[model samples]
Target: MLKRLLCLILLCAALPAAAWDNRGHRLTGELAHDRLQASDPAAVQAIVAIMARHPDKARFDRNLAGLTGEARTRRLFGLMARWPDDVRDTPADRPDWHYALKIVHGWTALDWYTAGKAEAQWAANLATARNAAAPPAQRAVALCWLLHIGGDMHQPLHRGHRLDGSWLKSDRAGTIAWVRRGPGLPPMELHQLWDKVFDPTGVDGGDENGDVTRLHAAFAPRAAAMVPDGGFVQWRDESEILARDSAYTGPALRATKAPAEAPPMTAAYMTMLRTIAERRVIAAGVRMGAALQGLR
Candidate 1:
């Protein structure tokens, strides 16, 4: 029993700290695609053209074999959102670019550099996506990052991580903080719980049509109202606040060293988590659309 528990702990610890899974990223991208069609038809065409020049366009073509017309383009855009994650372990892999894990310390400006390079990467990628002097293929990659990082920025855990008390250092954005979702269920990482809060089954409700349409219809109005005027740094700061106030609440923060002894998330906590996850997904979509609309 001791050996099994230790193995499980090591397995959980090694799980990748991805901000949002494939479903979340795809939903955000699809919603943004729909928004662009409704608000900026020309930009939609421009973006599609740009994405055509992506270095992995052939792979995209193979995956989108039967898809054509608007369906093909929309799905293509969604694939771009997942490209950054898909390229992991390859030459293009940039693990640190996915998050900006700001330590919740009272450190001075001199120590701010200790945080991940996500914010700086965001600025650089946005500039690349907008720079006409750059190659079309390069802009396509940057555009993909914009779609992806926008979703990451809204994930509370991706912005700030706990370091005090039970965590002598950090939870690595909850990737190592094991917890139970319910009685008799196996222990799972806290970050994975939040990553799948919107789609707990990990299959998007097994709906053939997917969750983008349903989520967009349900949260479009709220997302529109909440969309920022524009400021990536400000958006990240909002997530940091949510991490401290919402994500680190209840039994989650009371993590102990034992995986088998991990606490179960309460019904109320799950309710709150789903609500925040829904808002973040829709907001990320609308914001991505708004950012793309600026393309000349």
Candidate 2:
């Protein structure tokens, strides 16, 4: 029994990180879009029209091809919800808009401001989401960030950067924060692994929107558990805590040790990480709904 338990632990600890990935973004988008659909159809319509004119509308439409009716509409909203991340190369991209801080163990807004980073762009982007006074096109752009950043900020890595000695070396929020749980697994980014978690396995073949629906269903309970009263700051604080507790600590430290040694993965550890990933995604979706409705 002891040996079997040890083996299970090894398998679990080896699981990858999750964040900044498209599928996770899409789930948050779809979940937020669903909330808006129920509470503010007009906001939904306005967003749909704006997405129609997205700088990369051609690609969005291509993704929409071959769908119809409610499915088309749901998929459209899901796509719109995630559209901002897809336009990184276009002029529409706002690099700072995606993250608020390179957080430390006990970071404050002052620390972020001192580092010359905005407290949170999503807060300001809300103006565009709320501004009926602004042109529809402009508001649509801000709305994308509002939706996109809600999910982005929930990513533990996004709220904080890993420190190396006295200097910050977060590897671009873990784009380069590599890890190796054991010998058999390939080296992977801490951020990339988190982003890859919660992906829908055995999804309805190629019908990605169906996968979106399925994902929302899977995460709905996690979203319910969030019950947030504040906004980005609340979420950011939670993510920052998770970063310290899970992302930067644990097997990660030993995984990259000088002796090239580390602890093994365990099922218990894997469950804890999954819980964090699912909860963050769901919380982002729920808060996004409130943010969208509040704008309207």
Best by TM-score: 1
lDDT of 1: 0.75
Choose the strongest candidate by lDDT.
1
| Model 2 C-alpha lDDT per residue in residues 1-296, reported as the tens digit of each score | 43233323322221212244667788887777666677777777767776665666787789889988656766775676577767766777655556654545322222333121224467677876688787766777777777777888788877665434322332445555556433555565556556666544312135565556787777765665555468767887888788778876666554342233324445565677778887787777778877877454
Worst 10 residues of 1 by lDDT: 105-114
Cα lDDT for residue 266, candidate 2 = 51
Each model's backbone clash number: 0, 12
**Candidate 1 per-residue lDDT over residues 237-292, each given as its tens digit:** 88888887899888787655678988888898888888888877787888888888
Model 2 spans > 4 angstroms off: 1-18, 103-118, 166-171, 181-183, 200-211, 221-228, 255-266, 294-296
Model 1 error, position 172 (Å)? 0.7
